[model samples]
Target: MDPRILDLFCFWLLLSSLLRLCSAISSASDHRYALGDLVPFYANKVGPFQNPSETYRYFDLPFCPPAHVTEKREDLGEILNGDRLVHAKYELNFRQDKPLQSLCKKTLSVEDVRIFRDAVRKDYYFQMYYDDLPVWGSVGEVVDSSGRVHDRRYFLYTCVHFEILYNEDRVIEIGVATNGETIDITEDKDVVVEFKYSVKWKETNKTFERRMDKYLQQSFLPQHVEIHWFSIMNSCVTVLLLTGFLTTILIRVLKNDFIKYSCDEEIADDFDESGWKYIHGDVFRFPPFKSLFCAVLGSGTQLFMLSIFIFMLAIIGVFYPYNRGALYSALVIIYVLTSGIAGYSAASFYKQMDGVYWVGNLILTGGLFCVPLFLTFCFLNTVAIGYKSTAALPFGTILMILLIWMLVTSPLLFLGGIAGRNSTADFQAPCRTNKFPREIPQLAWYRQTAPQMILAGFLPFSAIYIELYYIFASIWGHKVYTIYSILFIVFMILVISTAFVTIAFTYFQLSAEDHEWWWRSVLCGGSTGVFIFGYCFHYFFARSDMSGFMQTSFFFGYMTCVCYGFFLMLGTIGFKASLLFVRHMYQSIKCE
Candidate 1:
């Protein structure tokens, strides 16, 4: 084995062990504190309750500040997730209960009142952490006593109550109660606002290892579980039916076609020159814009592998809701590492197609996905900056990502392209192509690419539509998605459905004497993304309470990129499956 390969394998092992150790340490009661030892309380972020993605710095609001504030160091993932933990003024001692204590008192000016009123009206909430356990509290609330929209009162919660549950010396859980003092912020006058907090330590039998169990079940309601199971069963049924139907039809059709065309050489000349056999020469012809198709397929392959690895990690409990920033961090790192796969796949396919511009193919492969992603990121980042939201990527973080791409991703991609160009075999079609191009007969309305693509995409889209709803809720709402096992199952069903549907469509197109199945198969398979994007619209309008320009733009903008990713991933799967189907069908028929 190459030393570099061995070193890479060792590094992977080390990384896996570190992740496992971190997960174990996070849940274990390894950190013990004596009585009177200071327990640092860190304020995280504040955001509108309706929009989880819209978050701002804890101190963004005109709140009382500490004498000298310090920030808790965070990893790349945490920063990317907009987690800015800062030292809070609330003082707490482990195992030491404190009576109601004044944190800070300040006279709220008109501007402060306006800020508080707006926050209260928007139902803004704040988050904090103690002993790595999270706690949430609302900034204020709007009470409509008169049952009229215009007759509303905005009240700010001035006092916060913290209850810390501990097992022995380790903190098991932290809860925040906001039913303390409240003051009306409806008035614009200067008001003396006093922030107070009380800490009470309670003993619990719950072990430290089970400390995160509550959070795991925080959003896993009975109804949600039922819905998830229902979706999975529904998807499985669809896949079984669709697969059985496609298998039976394709087998019967291909069997007859094979027997008819496989007549002994003496009788083969009498057969009619029609059906898919008529287009054998054109079926394997390189599609137009070969570089783009290859690049999309390559990127799709990379995304396909990336999704599988991430979901597998999730299924094995490497990623959980409590592990802040870990999932996104892993996604970034894994994607960067997998850039070489995209390069290899794209370059090899292009080379096999007798492409000469290997360098251009490599560049297209790298940029096909990243270019759109970068543009979307820039748009979203601009909106975040305009709204003063923490979702905006910091300049340093952006620079770091670019550096990773430049230093690691780009080189690996180039090396993979080189290896692929050197090692890949030439295109070997079972049937030789004629010098003149074959004219495709006029296709019927139903046989046209548009209708075929729509029909092809709907089955795969239906298979995962229910699950998409839950996923959207989990991502955009407060619901936590912990059912990775079911998600994985649905994902597999989706892939199978896409492949079968694409192959069936390709067969139909070929039978119609349209040998342009290359791009058609890819488009048909990826059309599921179009349906998904359409569903995003329905979700935005019918399902969610998300409004305003920022949230709306952010939702649709990111969703476009997500749907595009689905397009590439599923399209690649379809194209590969169709390619094999075409090769086997043509090869077995004893084409002339």
Candidate 2:
């Protein structure tokens, strides 16, 4: 091993140790499950409770068979108490045509408790609720003496169990002795008894996912219908108003400029006032830092398309709110599947820029985002492991993720890069570049990079601000967000807001005789992500009460990716919009 590499690893280990020590010493390392938290359970799924003809899907919850029918069942593991939405419910699979008997062999016990089928494993211990507090009671302790039930029965508060089967269709009774003791229902025959069971399940041998969306971490929401409307209408109005103003400016001002420049020669002198015509060539010249730009543009394009499709799936009811990490799993699968799109966009854009070194561009495009994601994941996982939290991915899962990236995604990217390199696009500009670079003149304060970025990002950020709050709360706080339709609408508005803001900023820059619009266009539109990160930082302190290093690391680690992806998506939108904006305006005139 290289000495420097070894040293670096040693240093990383030391840093990790220090961080864990600091987390331990910090005052906020509590990991206790809060009382009164709602314990969600999964209903046992059997062969088509409604229509016995149809096969069972994971989402299908089986209903109870008719009274007096006997059914044998298998356990989907016992339910357990967990933090947030960190746990999942396994479906209790029962033998076909099995039903609980109307009358079974009588027991000598005072009360016969239905033992929910489960042969326990160590991942999640069964958590039964007594007086709304979690206890490690098994299936036989069915009717605990605690009373949270009433005669009204507004909520059916217990997990539905299935009657399991033996190898033979024997008429064996579904009876479970209560370990040793029994609860006599006769003592409280008239009393209402409420019992609860929560499931924290996983696929057989599959471990728990380390981090889950905060909004989905719980199954509770305090939102009213009016608040949903408020979030949607606020964003819609912001986008509509900005769009209206831009439309008016374009129609009234640009219409006359186009007419005058096209027909009248004398008024054409005024067209040279700011000389947007002077740097038409430079404006369209290939942007510098070609590889990085292509990478950003490519990744952004893929994400843009992926987001639209994902939301479409959500709108169509593919991702349910309590579907237990289905959304995240789908996203990972999509990103891997879309690797080719990213590669194509990067290579094609780079080639169009007249950039050589296609291999370098491809490598950069692959690593630019993926590497950061891996590093952040490792950091968070390390923290989770240090804190002994269930939110840490085991070594096997991490290795599996790496294998997927390397074996599956990498080859797709290479194929895409090869295909895109063979494709060609011509750059159409009204003017030609001169041998010497144009000397740009100084501009007003608002036209400067900082001011332009702030203003350009402001409107777009405002458009999604309300939705963003909900999204963050869902990811970090205990909130359940299932409004996919509204989310899709807000996202479209945000895209429009970003494009218009970038186009406006680009126009101002060109008007000021500043030809540095390449990076400016990117920064202006991408700054919305910066503001988002800023808001997240503020939320960490102002809006959120989350504490502990493990939580903090997990929060920020994912936030970084979200912010970066946003930057790419919006920056690509701005860059492309500016190109079209310049082409439409300059090409309309006889600048050549």
Candidate 3:
């Protein structure tokens, strides 16, 4: 092994660690509180009942079975509060056309109560309300005539009794309420009913409150939307820049060196027994090069694109914790859409390896598309049925996904197959075989086996593992999106670590005389996921913070993407590095 390469690697790790530490320190300087105080204090609010007409119903819910609700049947887990509601509850109706005071004579049914319950449960988190004002609540005991104590709902309220009823038997109803006000029914009819609850930002310590007019005016402007658009555009530009740089490097390196080396014939003289000749043809006869190429190239592109998408969305508030399923959806969609990139990468590598078999290439390309979809169904089918997780692909959507893969990706893969089969690739390995055989060096405890080398790659990577864990935790635990800096750090770590590990592994493989360069790339490159899985396992036991269901989903869903991305990145790094090493070895040793 070159001491220079190893020292350079050690220095790289140190520098990366220092940069990350500096970034963390800079972020901490902006903090407003002590370590314990950094956790956000949330202000609980009750009702806005903001706009009831546009509320989502069961039938329209994503991924839900088409069903109509009449008399609401409470599924124990599905409905939040069951026994608290008074059955056949009172309802009131008002017409925007008629003044609220004039149209107050409306009767109510079970349906109106159901609508109110669903709206409150689905949209808001407040547990207590009085005449529509949110209040802090306490549990108290009330004695029934039977002399048994029952739970009573106690909330601070100015109103004595609240009645709800429905009028005109409308399918949907909207209402509003103002601060502790009772309607004087029987005069005007145009006033829409509204309920208002004022909340303060828990983080803001001051008592100042914005005027209602100003708040309303500010909320209507979509300034945040424009910010999100700009963030995505910036991310796309970054990806293009990185891609162009990598492309230029790849092309230049390929042009400069072209030979691949397996074993030096001169080195054979150093062996104790000439019987070692049995290890010749089989020496460089590594696994199918196409598979390795496909995995790496596909993954590199996927990682690059995914990091851009995630960070961009993070910047835009789309990947924020509250956006349920957005992260998972992003991951699934990226992989599905990147099939073309994967097929093309795999095909190119296979061509470089001088491998043939168009039928095999076609089958392999199609399989990558099907595998993830199958796994997704295994994990999400139940959730899809339960929440109608509305995000899961509908039948039509799934069919469309398959059609795109078949029609669009499959053809490109076929073309790649033809190109790969017909293409002539030169092997530069015999040059290394003829060159003065340098003594094969021994690896330390770290770089010998596939597992050890993989773990070694995780050394620099785990320095930022804390931030990664926090990001994953926030996603699982439903935290807000305020921690954008941490996300960017995570993005940088994944990219840098992938590149470093690939370079390191290629160096190690070359040192160990395992010059079956292409397959070695996949092995060393794919090893990073093993370390990621280890970290995930540690998180599983260490963090007792997530719900069982969420924990399960996060673990599997996260593992799926991590493993997929790790292998993909490894393959890419491994292949390119291996190609470069082979070329370097060949150019150095080839006879004139």
Candidate 4:
């Protein structure tokens, strides 16, 4: 191999090693612990079971506080994930079991009663951590078995059972059970709540490396593994059928058309012009809004690559659900690093199109996705602040993100734009454009761009909708999504289906003598996003139990951003595929 290639490979290996080292250090604890060594415990967040995003600090509900109240230092990803780990009041020792002991006894005031009552009514759950392993338990519950809103007794869970599993001296897992003492705080006068806890340590043969495997194996996932496999196989079958149909139809039709055109050129003095051949002169005409289109394509290209890299990393176990904020942190860092690709793609494409406004194109490319996302984030942050939820970003976090954009992302983007503008060649079209545009004939409503887009989008959407359900459940519900390999396969299928369907629709549009397939091709491919958004609506109302303004806004707002990204990525794929198909078709025939 060349020295340059060797150098690149070495660099990649170094980076991967560093990343793995960081991950291990972040997640794992020293296996050897001396007897009576203090094991630090941390209280994380509390939230309603139904609303995953709407979390608050663990102490928000007047929970017992630690003497010093120190917070655990967290990285950017952890903060973004809404983790707020504070020192817990419980005293734990390595390999030492504590019998049922009194943690804290407090007399509840009227205000405290109200808070506890609300939390119990909402079915709040709290999370804690010991040696990097997480434990979760419910706060309280309503005493009425029938679940009647009126005349119900509010019972607070005041005791905890901690089961710690150890492999030799290494702590492997921590389990929490809240089915302990319950005290009724039905009246506000004077209710003394005594909080208690017991610790039990047991030996296990499981290695420290496999400690997190338990959290990944949720009971719900085991039961649904067959369904997940079936869904993936169904999507694979869809792709194969779609691919076969498109290949067979396009091959037979194109062959006949190619033979007919070649024969006519050989014999006829003046061959009758019809179908796609009639508008060959104007087919390569530059579309309107060149700058915006180029910017979109550029951003789409960057997103496309970013997604692939993230998925590849996930498949290789760089991050998992147990690793709090690792995936999101990777996404943010990779996106920042890849900003240059967006600028370069846009600038190069714009240059090829003979566009003069280089600076404007760069600016547009940089802002195309960031601007909308920033605005949405601001709005959501405002809502989070209003609700005093942990989802709201801190001022410092926001500043850090801005600094990253201004200092790092912007400079890389400009550098890429400069490189692209200087290095790229002029756009080469297989056929020359005519000075006068060809007149397109009117067609039936079903053949129109909108109708074609709807039809074109359905196939790709159908391929992924089933997978989308599990994804939504994982994100919005308590389900763990550990099947990245299957997800990666489905993603590939979705891309293939989108490209093939978009190309077929483009062919149909061109056969109708419509040379304005530039934007139509993109729209046809991107229409899957609209379908995805529509599915979001169905999921929100019909499937999810999510309610309240905060949850509703969060669900729809973030989903819109997701669907828009899908639109851009798939749209770019479609346009590129159709472009290739058009060029090959025109180049193979005598279009002069």
Candidate 5:
């Protein structure tokens, strides 16, 4: 590979990103609106990654007030930019409880006030209740006592405020209704009057209050459609770049002869019918315990990365709710990006195994990947559409999914398929297995079975369950997108750790005269996914606090993603180890 090519590739991608950002800014001017003082205010909602808005206050009106109204008026100076002077005006509306006079014959006491406040607190939208409901809550308070003293005297005044969180897809409406209606022990019909508070912009300082509403009304806002477009462009570009890189690597792999060549035919006569390698007419087998140890290590490395990448993309805003095809979009993106690891590991394994049927290898690997994914999608889609569930992908979204597969994922995958065609390195790593193998009589029962080896991989994954829960919670409950940074780091750690652990266990297995390298490597490396699987279940049943339908959907959705990731990891590391072992065995025999 040319260093300049890599440098130039990075440079081009960076430049493209910068250009996209600039384009976003250039279009911003057209969307700007003039500020006014008397504009009517609407409730603003907070969203992931966006800051809260600090403008107009919000108060919830009852269902029976006939119509809503605003009260009180205040003008906040003006900002003069060029020919325009924007003045800000505020209004507050209060209603007197004249109708409540019929129900409340006596003055209200503190105890009644407490009961009313408690009831309202539990009943009303307490924590942007609708906005963050089912997951988290917002900041706010409640009233202590209704200040109504006599028949005509109403003692409660409600202060309301709206804290705008984000401005991405839809404007979130979060209202904090606090401090109103204080009554005595009896449940009096306090006419329960509601008030409105608002602020708007104005062109002039004089009559700013009157003009404020006009300013707000005239302020033109671009529909969420534009933002969604921007996000799509950015996501498309990123996916393209990643897909392109994978394709390049895959193409190179397919072209390489040594990497593609399988040794199964050449070595067929040398092995026993039971698939055991031999030395000096004796079965050269690795102790079962050591093999399992190696598999777990390898699998762990793969799982860590798969999880991180999936979450990172989610957190980075690429798959936000505003995007119509977020789930499918994510699926395609992750699958394509994953090809690099898959190719490297799988190809590396074939080399070790001295395997035959390169074409078979390629087909098997790709099929293993695509089948599970298609099924998962089909399942999700069926449930979503048949049930009119928000979870289903729309036709347009399905097109997006196709675009991701055809334009992004398939291309990269095809390249990986090609690259995996070659099998040159003979062994994945430089290290070679020694000849005239020293036989260790010691053997463990756990190493012989596939289940036990798989279990080894499962153990370490358990250690990291706590971290996995945080990731799940963030995605499902919080609905936050954009987790790339943390994901990248986690991936690095998983890869390095798996490699290191495999190498360590391999050394031990070798010293112990355990030559059953094939399954051992996979068992050691693939175990991580098992651990992740278990932890994911634990999170679903025990750790997660999410309630209702969301809980069920989130659990299954995330589980599907994690399970796929696990299989990929197992395939990669297991394959790599097997390849490495084969090379070592052959090298030792040739030298001897």
Candidate 6:
């Protein structure tokens, strides 16, 4: 063969090897970014990297965008901006995510340049919250790439995942990068700005836009399917057990009692009159701490209704995850609006209990729940301020919240109180109370307050205990929980469990000839929150990897208030259920 032929053959072989190498490298890179490569905890969770440019008067701390972000990482598109921002810099809203990455390394005209510069001056080095973190992404200014200067700007933006090496001192190190460009485009000839990205995610199997579809698909991974069922089934079993026991009691006891008592022939040898019949007079007596009872009921009713509406809207797909701010706003507005219900429920009940001093009652009703919540929030916010965490609310935000509380809630509550006070409805107790209080008899160990409360609470907790795990993970760990439908079911089941369990306890207390069932009924259902708080303690001690005073204070403080609210709500439900039960029992028999 001639020299030319030999050279051509060598060139062909070399080109073939180069092509194969490039192909292999590309395939490996794709596999490297697969979901499997990431830690299971982080692979499923995504957070928005927020801008931390704001400097508040009191302290320098950023505020979290999605209030439910720490609770459940739902898609916020409906509440915030759901649409992905294109190569535009106009959107700098507090709720909207910081703009990132130029489409094809965009070149802005003179007008675009001025607008972008203004945006940058306002909020440059845009911040985002992602992977349960706040990351900084810088904005770059690039001149025209073409030789002809058209008064243009060029730039790039990116996200980055960082790691801290804590020795004697904490050393911040930037790790994996998020598609940031290496080329600097600030100079002449052609200017470009490259944004940096975080490499914190262990793996990202596919480029999100790798396959674009017209229909938007929310990220609802099926990994938690098994755990979800386990939770649901566990709750179902508890309900089944409760139903079985209650059914048997209803059949065996109520049938016999109703017949003998209604006929006014209690001397029947087979029918035992050892139960609620003994407490007819005392059953109608007003309970101790009636003021607190009314308050709890009022607030509980408000919370229950608020939860229902929010969950309903969420299930209907109104509060989409991308627009998470709407959910927070909804919660704030709803909570304020519900004050009327709380006030009416509290005041009317107080009046019915033969209580006067409507002013004191009204004040206590609102203050009881709100005071603790506000205090806890303040403490947590203070901690956040010290740590420079985004959870801190600035003074302005605090003022706005306080104003909303004072302006909207205060008036509603006052009107509700007046409405309740002036109402013609009187106390409708079925049985007349004795002039003197009746003494309660000795109770069995299992029928004691503590034992009954513990037993009653366990059943209700089972309904939500599994769901709690995912909730904690979403809030404390990097997990997203958008299963609103399942949450609704669990909530209903929990309410049922609490009601039934309290009723069961009331029956036993009545059987033991103890007439102090009012507080016990509340305690019986509210004890579930004690168990929830216990689990919170356990979560902090064992399950969670959270550290630092900011996180610690925020978790424990807010959760304590949550537990308190839960206690109020569940306890109220239990009391209502037991009241109905007691009334039904007495109504069935003709009073002698």
TM-score of 2: 0.66
TM-score of every candidate relative to the true structure: 0.95, 0.66, 0.51, 0.95, 0.49, 0.68
List runs of model 3 lying over 4 Å from the truth. 1-296, 299-337, 386-393, 415-424, 427-447, 480-490, 516-518, 549-554, 589-592
RMSD of each: 2.9, 15.4, 17.0, 4.0, 16.3, 20.2
Which tens-of-lDDT digit does each residue in 451-501 have in candidate 5? 554544543343334345445654544333333444444444445444434
lDDT of 4 by residue, 312-415 (tens): 78887777555777777778877887888999999998999999998999999999999999999999999999999999989999997887777667777888
Give the number of colliding residue pairs in candidate 6: 46
lDDT for each residue of candidate 2 in 521-554, tens digit (9 for 90 to 100): 9898899999998889988888876654556676
Better of 3 and 6 by lDDT: 6
Report the Cα lDDT for candidate 2.
0.59
Supply the TM-score for candidate 6.
Answer: 0.68
Clashing pairs in 1: none
Q: Indicate the worst ten consecutive residues by lDDT in candidate 6.
A: 55-64
On TM-score, the stronger of 1 and 3 is: 1
Q: Report residue 517 deviation for candidate 6 (angstroms).
A: 0.7
lDDT minimum window of 10 residues, candidate 5: 75-84
The models' CA-based lDDT, in order, is 0.87, 0.59, 0.41, 0.86, 0.39, 0.62
lDDT (0-100) at residue 350 of candidate 1?
95
**Error in Å for residue 220 of model 1:** 2.8
lDDT ranking, best first: 1, 4, 6, 2, 3, 5
Note the clash tally of each candidate. Answer: 0, 19, 37, 0, 73, 46
